[model samples]
Structures are given as C-alpha cells and as structure tokens.
Target: MTNDAPLVPRRVLLRTAAVLGAAVTTRLLTAGPAAAPGGPAPSAGPPSAAGPSAATPVRPDHRLRPLAGHAAAEGRRRLPTPVRTRPVLRMPGAGHPMVLTFDDGPDPRYTPPILDLLRRHHVRATFFVCGEMAEHQGGLLRRMVDEGHVIGNHSWSHPLLTRASTAVVRAELERTSEAVERAVGQHPQWMRAPYGAWNRRVFRLGAELGMDAFAWTVDSLDWTEPGTRTIIDRVLNGAGPGVIVLAHDAGGDRSQTVTALRTYLPRLLADGHRFTVPVRGEV
Candidate 1:
C-alpha cells in the first residue's frame, strides 16, 4: 500500500503557493499567441488502450505546487491500501520497465518538439494533460492519439483536488476527461492528481470514474529548470524496475527536459530498458 503521509512537506507547500499560481496563470495568458486565430480543433480519433496491467505507476515532487494543509492531511488519511490500490509510490512486480510521463502539457511550442523526439526514438509514453491545455491545443492531443501515445487526465486547470469540494473535483476531472474524449474519441481511464495531493475522496472519485490512481516513482525535477545533465542524472541514477519518471511538457521552459530526454532516453533503451504506459483494463 502507498504511504498515507503527505507527499510534499507542509512548509514547502506553504512557501510555493504564490509562485505556482503565477506560473499557471502566466502559462495560459502567454502560451503562444491565441492559437493562430481560427486554426481549428481536430476531430476525434480512436483512443489507444495499449494493454492491461496489474500494477500501476505514479509520481509527485517537491517542485510541484503546494497542496492545502487540511486537504493534504485528509488526502494522506484516505490513501488506498498497498495491495489493492494502484499508487502509493511504486508499481510492484512490474520489472525493470520504466514509464515516462509528461504533465500540464500540449503546449504547441514545446510539446510538438517533444513529440518529434519521442517519434524519432519510437518510444511510447503517457501524457497526463490538464483540461485547459488540451482545450487550447486539441490538435496536440489529437496528434498524441494519432501517434499512439497514452493520454491520462490531470484535471481541469491543475487545481489541488483535496482542497476542493466533491462536485468541484468531479468537474475538474470530468471536464478534462470530456475534453480528451472530444479530441481522441474516448475518456481517459487513468488520472494523476496535480501535485500528487490525492485524498480518499480522489481515489473514490477516480475509481468511480474508471481510473486507477498513479504517482511517479521518480521525479526528474526538470520543472525547476535544473540543468540538462542534472535532469538526466536524476532519471538515470534513480531508474530501476517499474519506475515512473515524472516530467512536464508545459509547466515551464522544458528545453532541459527535451535535451535530457534526447540524451537519456536512447541511453536507457540501449541499456536494455523498455518503456511502457499503464493501459486501462483488468486492474
């Protein structure tokens, strides 16, 4: 079972609130010149299931925004038990396989290039997208589906779910799910709470919505604009069986993430490691 303790320290959460909110606002307000006027949202396409698995993966990090204190406590109290719940920290028995995931994305500038790199390497990854982002860049979502990447719901606007009411939480998840469904023809079956601040309510809601909770086993800390080598080393030094490496495509300048991926992705593959996304079914 995943630990019931808070994923982020109380002090850290308190300290970073203003900064995170600003970043989110700045990202939306200045993401890239209003999508070129009437560029058009893409039509729906078939969504990918990939395959089923008994184990699931998830991630959280100090670099993410804070979770409200009371909410954080409640969330920790509600975490699912180790054997049956999908995420606590790691995916048990899934082997030296690694899952690479990007959150808060579909940013046209960075995501497209990141997608190109993944395509070049023929690597499949999961993208945990925020609804606002997908709504703004549906084409990117469509391209993700078209290219055989897994899309998971990250929430409507990247709010801390534990702090919101049940209705708000549902709306956050459902709205995003609907947006992704519109883009890719099916709702996502997996979810990762923003900042990994999941509470019992989140788990229940996610299960009700047919999702298995997942958190990353490893965080690259790339959002901090850490050097490329640092990010690469964080992923490489920490990687092991059933590890999920957390990264972001849109939270900020992800050039370091892009470069780090270019350096470490192939290296991981060359070192006899395989990448996989958690599929919906049988878990």
Candidate 2:
C-alpha cells in the first residue's frame, strides 16, 4: 500500500466498476453513426407494411432453447439466398405489427430492466447483440430466449462494416453468430450491421451465414442521449404497421431508452400495433 493510500475494499472497487459499466459501453457507440446511412435524422413516419415476402410458417424453435454443447462451426450453417442490396426496412405482414429492436447490448445493468419491462408487458422484441458483450453475459442471452425474445447478431465489435476488410467484416459477423449459438443453442437468424452501414459483402456474408439484414424505419436517436420525452415522441410519431423502431439497451445511459420503452410500448399496443421479429422469408 502507498503512503498516501486511502483504504478501499476490493468488493467496493468491484461494485463501483460495475456501476460505471454502462458509461464505459458508450465508447462503442461512437464507432459509427448511431443510425448509419449518415445524414440528417429523418422525420418520423409510420412504417408501411408492403413488400414481397415468402410465406414460411414461424419456426417452432423460435422460443428460447436449453443450452447444450457449443460447437460454433457445426452450430452455424451456410445458407444460399438471393443477394440482398439493402436491409429490410419494415415487416411485411398483417395485424399491423411493428418491430422493436435493441442494439449493442445485453448489458448486465440496463438489459435486465428493459427485459423486465418487456416481460411485464408480455411483449416480444428483438435484440441485436454484440459478440464481445454476449460472451461475458450469456445468461442475459439465455434469459432473452427464455422470455421469448429474438436475438440477432450485431457483430463482435461495433465497426463500420463498409470500411473494414472483407476478412475483418466476416469475422465480425460470424463471431457474433457463433457466440449467440453457443449461448442459446441456435445462431441468430437476424443480423444487423453496425451503424446501419451495408455493402455487397455484408449482404452476401449475412445470407451465407443463414441470416437476414434488418434496418430500422424509425431512429429513436436514443444513442444520442436525447431526452426521455424526445425518444418517446420519436417512437410515437413514427408508429405504423410493419415499422422497425431502433433503440439501444447498452452503449451508454440507456436509462432513457428503457423508460421510453415503458411509455411508448403500451401506447402503441393500445393503438393496435403488435411487436414482432423479422423473419428471413422476406430477404
């Protein structure tokens, strides 16, 4: 101990470190534009439900599965599909369904509260998780499944996919898929590129990994640390059928996002908007 050292317990240091983890996660957000497709934020609009999609019945295993032996390579399968040039902007189905997607998370502190809210409301949403975070918090991933939430790949580390090398990009996507597989007994079928950036390589690699690309229709701008009311306004104003609302559970001060979810979710539900996950048939 140093002469000037003030006594502090190891347990206290650990607890303090844990409390500040959410702020630490914020650095990852600056890796790229929060919504990608960099430009002025678009005016909020209700998502329209009109697009060509295949009619595949929902998979029975869509719910959470028991954790088993994890073999990343065997767990992942190569899928061949028509090349996609862009991300799926909205869902194409009936019942006026709107999708809720949280990116860059599964944080120990923030994710649990968000998950609790979703559970209380009896709603199912999608989480686009990072591999780096997922590996450390596999239990959160398992809880997501157990609660009937969808897990999608958000890459290993948040990076601009278009700027990275082909090999680098592949690793980012594949590693996240594998980590998720190792956690939930199934790889994520839905994959979202960080910063909403997309390219030929991204689309090709995603399909090959048996994944589909999902982008948001409404940018909550929650990543900006916008006020709680602003986040709610964005979602409420943008409410429409088949629309995908983008928010984050990790990556800095998601308390606002969490609160906004509780506020807007029920209002949207009362307005006859159903929350659903994206299926690959559309891709």
Candidate 3:
C-alpha cells in the first residue's frame, strides 16, 4: 500500500491549463480536417489505438482537456530572464550531448539491466521514478543515486493530468519527491508530466517545489512497443545536441526498450555523442 495524500498545489491547476493551451493551439494550426473526427479517409499502417480509426470511438477524454485561456495569464507571470544562463530550448554544449530519460520505472525486471548497460557505457541518464514503484524498490533508488544517475519525480499513481484535481497532482509529486529523498537522501530537482501533459498549474507547482519542468524533445514512443528496430530508428534519426529523449524502463514489458538501448548506446557513444544529465542552474 502507498501513502494517500493530496499531490498537487492550487497553482499547478492554472499552469497546467496554460501548457495545454499551447499544445492545443499547435495541433489546431498544423492539423487538417482529414485528421479531425469523422472527416478522414483511411491511411496506411496498423489501426491506431489512440489514433483515428472508424472501428473505435475516438472521443477525447474531457478530463484531459487543458483549461481555457490560461496561457496568456501564465505568459504574464513568466520567470525573469537570468544572466549567463543556458538557453531553455537549445541543446547542451558537451559534444553532441543528449539526455536519455526513463519514466515510471525502477522495475526489478528491467531497471537493473538498464542501469548495468548505462554503467558499461560510462553514461549517465535520468530516471523519473514513480513513488509507488520506488517505495517498494528502495534499493534501486539508492543505486541510481550512488551510481551518479539523476532521479526525478514521475508522480505516484501515474494518472492522466486532466482527470486529477490540483490537490491530487500536488500529492503525486510531493509524495514521490519525499520517497526519492528518503531513499536517496536528496530531493528531485526535475519532473516530467505523465503523457507529456503539462499546464500552468503543473509548471508552477513544480517550480515552486524547486524543480525544473522537463519535457522530451524526441519521444521514442517505446510505450507502443514498436519493434526494437523501429525504436532504434526513431532515436538515431532524432539524435542531436541538447535533445531530451524519452523512453520507459517500466509500465509494461520493456524487452524491446532494453534491446534497443543495447544497440543505440554504443553507437551513439562511438559517434561522439556524450550522454549527460541536466546541470543545476542550467534550466
């Protein structure tokens, strides 16, 4: 059993709304009527479980919708520009650097091997660990810190943000941060919203808690379990300086993720790309 507590703060609700607005705006600008509901002809590839498929009803989850008009308000409250700071959207400056981040993990079945492979390659990556998962696997959490890997908060139960109340989000983050601190003796400095979902509230609360909000630049989409080759292709094609690549160590059978890493890590290293973590005062 896990500790039951309210996770998110009041500010997070507003912040989450803002981030969602940006995402929805981008989608509307780029998407066509064919991509809209009941307006499209069939395209190639497997029927998408999350995509438009006539066989399945594709109702958007109302709970996941971003709060309206929150973006403008957040824009007014943006953080002050700092001197001598790294650009928020630029890549890191450490020789074709890229960040590899794993979410919802510390699984005994998968995490150990992932950690071992990282060790073998002399690389460091970030693990956004679920509190529930880490609480039960404290040793893994300890190992992550001991081995110089960065651990981040990935919420407790991994609920979709649109469905959770502000309080719920705060609880998810705080409890997970507490768990990481207890196990590793230091609090997390970073967090990634579940499902790439972000809003004003999520960003505000994370910043208030002294964490930098991180989103991926390249999504391996490993969660879909595309074959190992597909996963490798996505990462290699997307590789670049300062790119944050998202993958998962748990949340399902991750055999393909494990296999793909074995192929790409060595290749990336040989290609002169150095794996790194986000430095403090950099984000």
Backbone clash count for every predicted candidate, in the order shown: 9, 1, 22
What's the true lDDT of residue 104 in model 1?
Answer: 76
lDDT per residue for candidate 3 within 156-269, as digits (tens), equals 767666467889988998898887766655667777777666677777666666567776788888867889999999999988777888898877668899999999989987
The true-versus-predicted C-alpha distance at residue 174 of model 1, in Å, is 0.6
Ranking by TM-score: 2, 1, 3
lDDT tens per residue, model 1, 138-210 = 6666567556567788887777788999999999998988787666555676788888888888888877776
lDDT of 1 at 13: 35
lDDT of each: 0.66, 0.69, 0.64
Residue 43 accuracy (lDDT) in model 3: 20
lDDT of 1 at 137: 64
Q: What is the lDDT of candidate 3?
A: 0.64
Give the runs in model 3 whose Cα sits over 4 Å from its true position. Answer: 1-96
TM-score of each: 0.71, 0.74, 0.68
